[model samples]
Every structure is written in C-alpha cells, then in structure tokens.
Target: MHTLSQLRSGKLKGIKRLDLSCGLTTFPEDIFSLADSLEILNLSGNALSSLPDDLPRLKSLKVIFCSDNQFDHLPEVLGRCSNLCMVGFKANQIQTVSAAALPLELRWLILTDNQISHLPAELGQCHALQKLMLAGNQLQSLPETLAACQNLELIRISANQLQALPDWLFSLPKLAWLAFAGNPFCPMPPASPHAPAIHWQDLEVAEQLGEGASGVIYKALWQQENPRAVALKRFKGALTSDGLPQCEMAACIAAGEHPYLIGAIGQVEHPDQHPALLMPLIDGFSNLAGPPSLESCTRDIYAQDQYFSLENTLKIASSIAAAAEHLHAAHILHGDLYAHNILIGPENETRLGDFGAASFYTPEQNLLQNIEVRAFACLLEELLSRTQGSAATLDKLANLQISSAQVTISARPLFSEIKKILSSL
Candidate 1:
C-alpha cells in the first residue's frame, strides 16, 4: 500500500516492490525513478488505460499487475520488458492483446474477466508458458499452434464462447488441471436426482465458509427435520470457466454415495430457485495443500510442516483413487483432481469435494481418463516425495505413479488398476 506521500518524500527509495492503488487516473511518472530497483510493480485498482512506452526502463522488472483497471488493450510496451514473465490484467476491459505485447519468456498470464475474443498465433512461441488463465472471456477457439507449448500445464478457459476444444489440447503431456466448462461443445449431464431438495426458507445462510469461481459455500442450520448443522452451497447463477452451476449440481446428484466423497444430502429449493446444495458440515479437516504459487506454476505447495506417515500416505491415495474410480464408472470426469482439492481429517480420513471442474463423458473416451490420470499421477508423486515409507512400499507407489503418468496416453493404466496396486501396498 505505497502512498503518494511516501513516494514523493523519497522514503520508498531503492524498494524492490511497489503497490500504489490510490485510484489514480494515470501511471505515476515518478515510478520511472525506481527503474533500477523495482522488480514488481502493482498498479491495480486504478483508472489507468495504458502504459508509458518507456516501461522497459525497469530492466529488472519481473511482474506487473494492473487488475481492476480500465485498460481496453494489453499494453504493447510490455513486450519490450526482457525480464517480465508474469502479467495480470484481471477484471479489466481488455479486448485486444497484440502479438508484440507478449514476451517470449512469459510463463504465467492472467486475463480473467475480460472481453477478448481472439488470440494471436504468436502465443505458441511462448514455449516457456506454464499457467494461463483466460476464464470469463469471449474466446471462440484456441490456436492449434498452442499444442507446440508442451510445457504448458494448468489452463482455465471456462465461461468462454469456445464451440469446440482442439484434440491437441488434451494430449499435452503436462496438462494437469484444466477447466473448459460453459462452452458450446461440452456434454450435457444426464438427468438423475438421487440427492433430495431442501427448501431455502428452512435454513439461514450465515457467514460464508469459502468461495470459488462457481459458487459460495456457507455454514447453515437446518431447522426442518434436524436442528443440527449443515453446509450450504449456493450457485452464483452465472457461467464459470468450468461450466454451468446446474451441471455441477447434476454431477453431484448423479455421483451417488461414496464414503470418500463429501456427502451431498440434497439440493436447495426456494422461491427464487437459486441452485444450491445441502451437505453435511465437515469439521476438523483442512486442505491438504495450497494452490500453486507463481514460482511453482504447475505444482501444489504443501505446508512445510505437513508430512505424512507411510501408512497415512497410502490411506489417502487409496481413498481418493477409489472415489475417482467410482466417478469413472459413472462416466463422470473429475477434471480438477489436484491434491490442493483434497480435504484431510484429523485421523487421516480423506474426502473429495469441489465439482466445479467435473464433467460427464462417455466411457469410450479413453483420452479423457488418460488426461485425469496424469493429474492423479502428479498427486501421487507429490505424496511420494513427502513420505518416509519403506523402500518396498515406496517402490510400489512409484511404479503405479509411473504407469499412471506414462506419456503415451494409451499406455497409462486405468484408475482401477492404479487402485489395485495402491490397495495391495
């Protein structure tokens, strides 16, 4: 929260980072003075529409964030920043991204909540790219050349106008987390309502437990049948990068009952009829890991103090794989299966939640399963590194992981097979 006062008094001299969000209408000319020391410049929450061409003067600058601004086009000056690899223009009005505006060394790019409709072919030239977020855009299609970016892993293209996904998009060896919901070509979930409905008038929506791109989860009291606690998730009533909320609800309902899955008891019924889920309130559990950071673009960041015992590691992996296999048998693909999405209880009990990126596909689509297998392998590999299991036990998990992560999509073992190996261990 750098202030104009300190910046003017030379009090912030030689700082490596600068955050000036005072609702300014233009870029402060004084920023150029820190060109020698500034590595990150965050000018978010401003009214700026463009950047000065001399932005390259910050020769060491590595990151630039201009979110919540009025920029209609990605700044062309950014291409000249030899060291700038991370750029964020989220919640801006950006509609055009010039080819020259992208740097070849760019790794992470965020353009969420923009009005962009097309991308330049030069995007494929960014071979070093890893994470790309273009959710909430008007992208009709992706350039086929992007398949050349083999290092690319995580991608969010939900809530877009994509009519179809490219074949190459799914075959990328490193693609672990991907969401392409809300597209015209996505499959419609089958009609099946196993979970019953609970009227909204019976429960009070209280303090929010958490929120995601698709919906908000809240802790509520169910006063109708049981005067006990429950978790209520109300959809945002808008298309997300993963797809429609109704689709997620449908998957949850069709998912049936599984001990490892978060219990979805029913749906929410209201006069306004907002799609919501009634779930068991889980306690004494925490996320197993955090979302990937800028540096670990495609991998999760587990807590430094968090390490699992050999038995606990196997138990967690077995539970998640069983749940995944169950979903597969139901023809549902849990598109986002990263470890960060897992919840761990005090006794090492595991539960799988978050259907935001889940999708329904035919059993014949073996490639879809293969794509998810890569994610499972990545999760297992992470667990393998964090455990102190015996050499034999470690060897078995490693072999299963290797088979799951096979580069040849056709060569990867089914989750059922992977589960067998894990269960035996």
Candidate 2:
C-alpha cells in the first residue's frame, strides 16, 4: 500500500484495514473492491464526493471514518455493511441522509460540522448507538423516532437552529452531559463585569487543556520577564453584561492562595471577542467524560485498578471536601459541584473547576436558593455513595453531620445526611 495505484491493484488481498488520510486528495477508482478483508477504513481529509457502491462487498467492514471530505450526500451502500459499528462524517458537505443509508449495528455516529437539515426516521433503528455528535449542523428539529435510542448517553446538538428541545430528549434514562448553547432553545445567563483587553499576538497558546459549555481553555505562554505560562479560559459570547472573563478573574483573585484551589494568573480581554481569564494551569487534569453519578464512575473504573484504588479515591475526596470548605469559608457557595467539575490532576491531586455557576454570599444575596441547596445535597449524596461502608467514610460523615447541624440547615436533614457522608469520606 505504498501508492494509491498499488492499493487499487487488488494485490493486498489479506489487508484488513486501510488509512488513506492526511495526503490523499482524490479517491482512486476500484480502491474499495481490492480489500475484501478490510474491516476498518479511514478516508478522512480527502476530496471524495461519494462512497463507492462496491464498499458493501467488504464482508468484514466494521468502522468507517469519512470526515473532512467533500461528500454532499450520505453513502447509500453504508446500510449494507451489517457489521459497521461506528461512522464519522464530520466536517463534510452532506446535506441529506436517506432513510435507508444508516447501518443497524452502528454504536456511534458523528456528523458534526455539516449542512444536515433533517435526520431520517430510520436513524432511530440504529438501536446500538450509544453516542451521537450532531453539533454544528443546520438541524431545525430532531425526529421523534430518536426516542427509541434507549442506550444513548451523550448527545451534542449545540449550534443548531432548534427553538426547543423535544420532551423525549430530556427523558432518556442514560442521557447526560447535554450542551445546547448557540441555540434559541436555551438562553445565556446574565453577564458580569468586563475585563481589560489582551493582545492575541502577545500570548502563545499551548495545548487545548479543557472545554465546557461556554468556551475552551488553553495553556498559554505570556510575554514577561520570566515568560510564564498560564491556563487561559476564553469565553464564547461577546458584549456580555459584565463579561464572563472578568467574573472568572474576580473569582480566582478573591479565591487567593489555597492549597486545594487552582490560583489565578490574571485576566485579559480578547483582541477581537470577549474577555478571558488566566489561571495557574494544572499540568494534567480532566473533567470526568461521563456524568457525575456513582454508577457512571463505577462503570468507567470497573476494570481499571488505579481508578478503583482506595488510597486514590480517599485522597481525591478529601481534596475536594477541603476545596469546598475553602469556598464556603470565603462566603461563596459552589452552586455546581459535581464529579465532572472536580478535576483530577497529577499524583491523584483534586481541584474544583468551572466556577461559572458559583454564587457569592454577600449582603445582596444572603440566602442560597432552594434549588441550589437541593443540588448541593445531591452532590454530597453522590460523593458519599461512592465511598459507602468504610471507617474514613464514617469519619467524613460525622464531620458533615456536625457541620450541617451547626450551619444554616435548609430543606431537610437529609441534606445534612449528604454532608455527613462527604465528611465521613
């Protein structure tokens, strides 16, 4: 498979896979017919207009990634590949998908960054699909048949023309981690104070560190005597009330130097867009990919020893508890403190991220809302449930019980029970 012509010659009869990405500009005719054993094919970053009709001849074909291509229509022969489990057609010119174009065994379908205006009703027949990425498309509405995808966990339908999300969408039992930003269905929260401008040319962006509903974060190198690098969080919207960048900067600055907290570097406005905040970048940290539920964590770490280690789990829980304590001490309630927002860094260190929804307890807003209190209780319950039936967990539970009893109690004592569970951990 040195050249495209050679690959099309049907010489590599036993070849089970083919990757013609990065350099290939055009699809060679008869390329699909040569490799009957081909089970996986990556034709991404190519100039192909359509999939060859002979693609279904490969009996062992299981996965195909045709993203970043010039295809204007969904490949019809794909449905014939009964074993196909995953298909990625992102960043293409696909405008329509016929009802019979989708495969049955497909477990993942990525069609982001396309011109897809409607999804075929037959897509609901792909019962095994567990993940679907349809962001950055022209979808005005989702088909009612999508309710049949009982196994769907993550759905990214952001940046669409949706004026409202279907009621069934919110009813998926496994559905979590939904982001519908840039859609008329969901509106942005009120803004905050604006920050000063910072030049893009002066800052060197390193690797993309994290991403959230609002924006992306990058490790950046700033021009200074020491040339320090910091984590820069760039917000998406422009002309926000006070500006999200300023709000984040103010939160970090007020947070000060705390052992359990990531420190603030500075704040700067984008040269072209909204403002951004710079903070001490944690070297390696990740927001848990799935939901914050205990079941999700158990499923993710069932076979992974490090993830299930008692020492690692205790250390992370303790660190998060300490961080929450610090925030409460500062008269701030971390309105949204879930497993996903709690990042795990090097050496099992834990740090709380995403303070976008945090609420400051000042004279203006003295009491936390019922919803906020309930959310905190739920978070504490989840944390405690993860470390059930342990001595250290018992101790943490006792501490939470005392703390909740002493502090202002809202809703029910069940809320205190959740706090007790956290303290016991």
Candidate 3:
C-alpha cells in the first residue's frame, strides 16, 4: 500500500517491496531506483495497461502482481526479469499471451478471470513451473506442449470452455490438486430427489461461520417441527477458481451420506432464488491447517508447533481415505483433498468439507480417480512429515505414501486399498 508521494519523495528508496494502487496508468520510473533491493512489486487495483521495456533493470525482483488492472495482454518485458518466477495478473482483460512474455524461471503463474482463449506452446519451456491458475477463462483447449512440465503439482482449469480433459494431464508425476468442474466435459449434476429442500423461511440465519472462494456459511436454526441448530451455506453464484457454486452444491448432494463427509442434510429454497444448502451444525471443530502461502505455492501451512502422534496421524489419514473412497464410489472427484479442507474434532474425528472443487465423472474415467490418488498421497506425506515417533506403523505409512504417489498411475493404490491398510495400522 505504498503511496505515490512516498515513492516520489524517495522515502521508499532501498525498500525490498513496493505497492502502488493510486490509479496508476503508467509505470512509475522511480521504481527503478530501488532495483538493487526490490524483490516484490504489487501494482494491483490500478489502471495500468503495460510496463516499461526495461523492466529487467530490477535485477533483484522475484515476484510481481498486477491484478485487477486493465491490461489486455501480459507485458513481454516481464520475461526479461532474470529472477522473477511468480507472476499474477488475475481479474484482468488479458487475452493474448506471447511466448516471450513467460519467464524462463517461472514457477507459479496466475491468469485467473481473464479472457484468454489460447496459450503459447513455449509455456512448456518453464521447467521449474509448479502451480498454474487459469480458471474463469475462455480457453477451448490447452497446448499439448504443457505435458513436458513434470514439476507441475497444482492446476486450476475450471470454469472454462474446455470440451474434453487432456489425457496427458493425468500422467504428470507431480500433479496432485486439480479443478475442472464447470466445463463441457464436467457439469453440475441434475437435481436429486434424495436431498429434501427446506424453504428459506424455515431457516433462521444466525452468525456467519466462515467463507471461501465459492460461498459463505452461517450458523442457523432449522425452524421445523422441532427446531434444531444447523449450518447453512449460500452460494455466491459467481465463477471461482474451482468452478461454479452450483456445481459444488450439486456434487455435495450427490455425495450422499458418509460418516467422514460433511454431507448436506437438505437443499435450501431461498425465496429470492439464492442457492444454498443445509447441514447439521458441526460442534467443536477447526481446520487442520492453513491454506498455502505465496512462497509455498501449493502446500498447506501447519502451525510451527503443530505435531501429531503417529497413532493420531494414522487415524486422521484413515478417516480421509474412507471419505475419499466413498466419494470415488459415488463417481465424485474431490479435486481438493488437502488437510486444510478437513475439520478436526477433539478426539481426532475428521470431517472432510469444502466440495467447491468436486466434480462428477463416470466409471470409465480412471484418469480422474487416479489423479486424485496423487492428491491423497500429498496429504499423507504432509501428515507423515509432522508426526514424530518410530514404529512398524510409521514404516507402513511411509510405504503407503510411496505406493500412492507411484509414477505409473495404474500402480498407485486406490483410496479403498489405502483405507484398509491404514485401518490395519
């Protein structure tokens, strides 16, 4: 949030980071004054449409964000920044992406909420790439060259015009997290009769519980024959990185009942036509970890002091495995299978929530299910990293992690097999 006045007065000289959002329509030349120190620059929420040709003068710059701007294309000068690896231009009108605009050291790239319909084949040259966010775009297809990016771990291609899923995407060894719900291949499920619809008037909304990219949840009272406390979720109805909120609710309903799942009890009939869901209130529960940070890119962040006993970690892992098994059995893909989406109770009781990235698939689509196995493996690795102690159970868990992350997708064990092994441990 640095002001133009401070920058103009040279008060921000030698700073390692700079943020200017005062309706900037052009690159501030003064920024180059801190080239020796600046590492991160954020010009989001501005009117900028381009950058100077010599943006590479900032030798120390490593990360840059120009989101919520008026750029029609990513600046080619950005590619010249030798150290820049992370680039974000979310919520812009960018449609063209030049081969020269992508940096060689690129690791994380975010182009969410853009009008991009195509990507350059040179994107495959980013050997260090890890995370990619291209949701809410007009892309009809992705370049086949992207298959060369073996380091890619997380990708968001939901809410696009893709007609089919790329077969090569499922072969990426490191790919774990994926979201592709609101596309031609995958769509919101048809209405289900199993989930009873509760009218809006029957819900007495209380305090908001929390919110995510797709919707907001609140504590409420179901005003029925015997009023009972419940949780209500109201969809935002906008395109998110994971896809549309309706798809999330549809998948949640289709998921049905499972002990480890935060299954929807009923659908909400809002008078104003707002999409919502009702479920039993979860008492005494909290997230297992925080979402990833800028540096971590796609990994969850656990508390510094957080440590789990081998037994408890195994218990938590088993619960999530069972939940995933049930989801796969119902032809649902929990695109997001991270610990951050899991709520933990006092006795290590885990309830997997947040179906915002869930998508429906047919039985023949082993690619979707097997890709999720990599995600499950990632979760197991995270938990095993935090658990301390030595036992036969620990060795078995380690072996399971390796088997689940096998390079050959077919070699990876299914969630059911993982669940059985964990239960035995």
Highest-TM-score candidate = 3
> Candidate 2 has what TM-score?
0.65
Between candidates 2 and 3, the one scoring higher on lDDT is: 3
Q: Native-vs-model 2 lDDT?
A: 0.63
Identify the candidate with maximal lDDT.
Answer: 3
Please give the distance, in angstroms, between residue 346's alpha carbon in candidate 3 and its true position after superposition: 1.3
Query: On residues 32-143, what C-alpha lDDT tens digit does candidate 1 reach at each position?
Result: 8888999999999999998998899999899999998999999999999999999999888999999999987899999988899999989999999988889779999888
C-alpha TM-scores of all predictions: 0.92, 0.65, 0.94
All models, RMSD in angstroms: 2.4, 8.4, 2.0
Predicted candidate 2 versus true structure: per-residue lDDT over 147-260, tens digit per residue: 899777557676678877676764454443343454565444333333224567668988897676557889899876678777888886531211233444555656666787
Ranked by TM-score from best down, the candidates are 3, 1, 2
lDDT of each: 0.84, 0.63, 0.89
**Regions of candidate 2 where Cα sits further than 4 Å from its true position:** 1-15, 22-26, 33-36, 194-196, 201-228, 232-277, 284-308, 315-343, 352-420
User: What's the distance in Å from true for residue 192, model 3?
Assistant: 1.2
lDDT of 2 at 192: 31
Error of 2 at 295 (Å): 20
Q: Candidate 3: where is the Cα deviation over 4 Å?
A: 235-237, 270-275
Residues 41-61 of candidate 3: C-alpha lDDT, one tens digit per residue:
999999999999989999999
